[model samples]
Target: MSKVSAFLRKKPLIASLMILLLVLTAGCSGSNNASQNTGKNQVVKGGTFVYGRPAPVTSFDEYSEITSNNAFAIDKVFEPLVAFNKDGKIGNWLAKSHSISKDGLTYTFVLRDGLKFSNGTDVTAKDAAFSIQQHLIDKGPLAISAQVASIKAKDNKTLVITLKEPYTPFLSELANFSNGILPNNFGGVSEKQFFKKPIGTGPFVVQKWDPAGDLTFVKNKYYWQKGKPYIDKLVYKLIEDDSQAINQLKAGEVNAIESLPLENANELKQNAGTGVLTSGSWSIEQLFFNTLDKHFSDVHVRRALALAIDRPALTKALTFGYAEPANSLLPPAILYNTNKTIKALNFDTNAAKKELAKSAYPHGFSTNLLIASGNSTTAHLAQILQQAGKTIGININIESIELASFRDRFFAYNFSTMINGGQADYPDADSILAFQTDPKGFSKSYWTHYTNNNVTKLLYEGQKTPDGPARAKIYANLQQILADEVPYIPLYYPDVLIGVRSSVKGLVVLPNGSVRFDSVQITK
Candidate 1:
């Protein structure tokens, strides 16, 4: 078989069936507005910009949210104090301007005049402070809350945030989903009831939501940005299948679709009335090992696994020329990612076998890889690992778990091994380094129960130092250490490809997997 064909090929029968289904029902189930799309340059107001989002939303509580996709939906209804622009630089969003104290421990923000929530009540420093406090109470993104000492609403427009120490990522962390401003105390409703119908100072208001169906949002007339959100309504229609979503894009049933399958990206980019927004996203598709397990406890075994797969070849075969193999824990797009600077553990079958012989499980050991089902790319990865594991005398069992349960198990650190991926919340190296490398991080340092004094020290060193050559040196050393230890194997860095209609304008597909929708307008 040819190289590309071999890697892309899977269970032929199932793959054939899925392809058949895509062909048979491509545009048949599109929304009522399904029709031929025609491109135009003029911006038209009062039109609905329907977005095709995969999977129904199960949660909208930003304070305790787990995944970026969940945050994507909630973000539409809640604007941040500040947000990263296309360049990953922090820019003022809700806060008109801000300044930091000389010691860098305190920050003062002045709210934009006439700011109001979806309910028309004015947005004040109190609301922002209350939102930050709520995030801390809910234990959202520990790195963020752990640094914040206190938040004070000095006046309706001025807010002061004091940190226990000078945390460099504090501003970027505030712009993340976990710190989005909401109504003070959830608008006087129970926590459960409030998130059920959340209100925020965002571009759109939640009109209705169905966990198993579509989520509709109407233009928030009270939205801080004047004459903005030109679309009369924004709808996140649940279309789980990539082919079907692409079909809807062509048929003009959906203005945009998230997570466009890489296989079809080139085709969609070439197709008329359709354009694909793709970038070298700041993320990685990788395997997380549970070092507590006897089989994985040995560094030799972990390194063996890393050397077995040809990351470059796999990425090339899978991404359709859209991305490069991840040479470091951070993707190449991230600043100071160390992709080219530090060489990765390249494919070495003989070296892998030698490393396995050094481990106690030289005769081989069996382990189960728990992965969430429904993702074809992940399933394919499991198969490749299963095959590679055999060469090293390891017996691999692939466990396909449902998405929701998989998350529950992962966060609890209840697994032998798992395949997972995510984009950094912010653009900086510290954004991911703090959470994925710090021992007390969100993922418990890549969910392996892995810990290292050197990594821990470098993580904090990188966080405390401001971004520059000095800070970059700290992260480079950190990456080198993690690479040698092989706590989590660096894998492919796939580009985030979003399917957009030709007429869709002002939509920003951020490399961090969150799109900016406030300025998104459908030009008809």
Candidate 2:
């Protein structure tokens, strides 16, 4: 057995700590009554909410596609076993109650009585088991089926899942949108047919869909949550242009839009008729170095590049003081943060030059910096890096490509350096750490091709250790090592800027960029 497994076996207190961490990270539930009024505002429902999305949704099937745009639309139709409430607590949705075994390897879930899908079919434990099996067969980008050793449906209402090993973040992972349950016997449905018409047990049902246009939804009359989903109709209008969306919001063509540019959001905030919401986002804009590239193979070269750019200035210029400079992959507010201050790589041209001299290329070299076109913020960030590189005697050529092409090339490891955004599927630190650092994980090629046996061991140990001072110490050491290794340069954690019409009430934007419309009401 590994040292972590041995430690877990010896320490009885670790199990309690694990439960507490799960609760802290998963978020708490609200009232059982979904339609309970806030008491602060009289919810005047029965209105059509025109929501503007920045991009067209690629697929309605969460199991097949992973995109924020798709999630915004799917959240209305599909209900996960557990969901994060507005307060960011894990709450029972499809499952009425759940329990974890003392050994941390078994999970039992009881389905809510009278649960039914949009088509009036019962949502049983067998359906949940089918969903897990489908995830395993499909092997989607966010699939977690490998974690399960076996899943058994005890009855129509009971499900028991046995894990291959102890996974601290299992509950939180189940709360992800990708794990949303599908109906039983859905294996025969083709991917194309499922994307065209997907069924779920959520508050709304798909009414109509127009490709590259607006997708409309109507309240599910038979929705399990009684008197909820106050809005009569919800429409997601695809507007690819940011400026055009802002103009629509100003002109009262749209009720709400998320992820607005910082500058535009600031301007909307100044308008009396506009309501702007800004909160620390789970997303981070970062620069990932291709460690396999000869130019960045040397640790000194990567360190020099990390030290050359100014993160604070970039945050201010790009997010207009709405974001905080990132010191580690896990945000300080997250439950896993150690609070130990690690020395950050500050911008210093002289220091960067000195570090570069230690590399094979004493006189620095040239490389291309890849970025997605049509993103003004990333474009400006690339320009700043270009200027910083000149000061350190390195020539950086900025290359902007279509978003689709950029994603393809990035995952294929075709770039020397790439500026992009990444977020954990769940609130746990293991989500990000495992994806970015686990050498045997699914995202190994997509991330910086960094391989360190010691770091890998530390990461695995951190996952097994319960949330406490010991776990904190493990993560602290990991962060310090990553900071020195410089596989990725942490930039800033951007704020989720959202603009809403002043009359739209009870709309809450979560830190993870999910907009809650359960209690939303429109007042003309």
Candidate 3:
């Protein structure tokens, strides 16, 4: 059984209590809406909104060190220094204004005066600097602070950051939740148990969290925003099954869904009067091969495998024709990506056979493809690849396991090949850089155990330089290297398909690919 299932089984009574609370809360929220008053098509102030998420958050307090779906979910309750605006521009949130030095190695931020955390503690420059320090010590995802020479508080109002090298993506890192400013003097839990209770400087406060089912958040009375967060509370339900999630939306049990399956996208689009469907580019879903594996270690075998698949057909079959065939690691329209020189993977069965003959396995060879359980999308892609491989006399053995187990397996290099979904948490080439080499002074996610020194040198150069043109040239060259190596075959860029209730308005679809719930208002 999965870790989550085992946890629920351990605390059956708590699970039962949460179920009872859910029933009562749902009943109250539903009935309370009838008598509550809100603007005609504008936001309401009293009602609570129920939302459906694919999986429950594993940790709420383990900020800066871990990345998960719940990271975004919890961020709603905790604010960030900068946010991706509707037009994909980085806008000021906690930091009222900011300025960069002429050399591009220093940044000075003017905090929004009179800001306070949900705990009523005043937010200061020390809070912002300390948060960044915390991430560097833990070697978190936003660990750019090591290169950061110093972060000094000019006063209670101004915070300055000085980097050893020019780093343009520092702004993008600040936009992440890890850099979110919390009260500097706050201390309560051990490092390991910190996630049990998380305090933030956002509009909502976590009132209750039932690990097995849902987490509840109530509006902070002292929120910094002016007349915002129309809803009184937010509830996130853990509904792994798509059918159950869709049923809950149709039944008005949940106002919004985390994601809508591509098969249901058209149906939801047709019902515009009651709800709407929105989509945008997510990260690249690619086929990654273990470079260290004996069979795939051969470049000829890797090239043959890449040439064998019919990517167009696979894209159509897996995404229901709602995705674009990927040509590079970074999304096409994402900021700072200029890899237009790269070309898509062309299907060449005859060429594939020629390359296969050149390899030791002239007839064919079998390998296992690892897939995440409960994710039918990855399973479908695996099946398509299996069929395509058979045409070239290559046999594929597909294996499926839940995300938790899959995480351990993928990290341990337990599989020869795998299909995985990578989300660009922030919009930049640096987001895709995680999957590349183990660059010095950087966090590594090169799970395929692939590395190239030339690519590594370019990545480091691009990271330290602040010039856009120079960085673009380096990234393009890096992508070209990957294309030639075929370490990970670019599959397709999947759409962030979503279903929204018609009663909800002001819910702008962000360019970075996440739901903007703060602006969302119920109009029923």
For candidate 3, give the lDDT of residue 232: 72
The stretch of ten residues in a row with the least summed lDDT in candidate 1 is 7-16
Q: Candidate 2 residues 87-196, lDDT tens each? A: 44676789999998998899999999999888888889999998877777777666673368999999999999998888777787787777888787663587668657
User: Which whole-number lDDT from 0 to 100 does residue 288 have in model 2?
Assistant: 79
Clashes found in each candidate (C-alpha, N, C closer than 3 A): 0, 6, 1
**What TM-score fits each model?**
0.88, 0.89, 0.88
Q: Locate the minimum summed-lDDT window of 10 residues in model 3.
A: 8-17
In the range 1-524, model 1's lDDT, one tens digit per residue, is: 00001110000000001010010001112223222234664444666778897666667887666565466777788877888765566778899999999889999999999999888898999999998888777885433633788899999999999989887777877776667898888889988898999988888888888978898889899988887776677888988666788888898888888777778887877787788776556667777788888888899999998988888877877777877788787777677778888866789999999888898877888999988775566777888888888888888999997666776787688888888774576545666666666677555765687899988998888778876789889988989988888888877877767788877767776656667777665554
Pick the winner on lDDT between candidates 2 and 3.
Answer: 2
lDDT of 3 at 161: 87
For model 1, how big is the CA root-mean-square deviation?
Answer: 7.6
lDDT of each: 0.73, 0.71, 0.64
- The collision pairs in model 2 are 26-90, 27-88, 27-89, 27-90, 28-89, 28-90
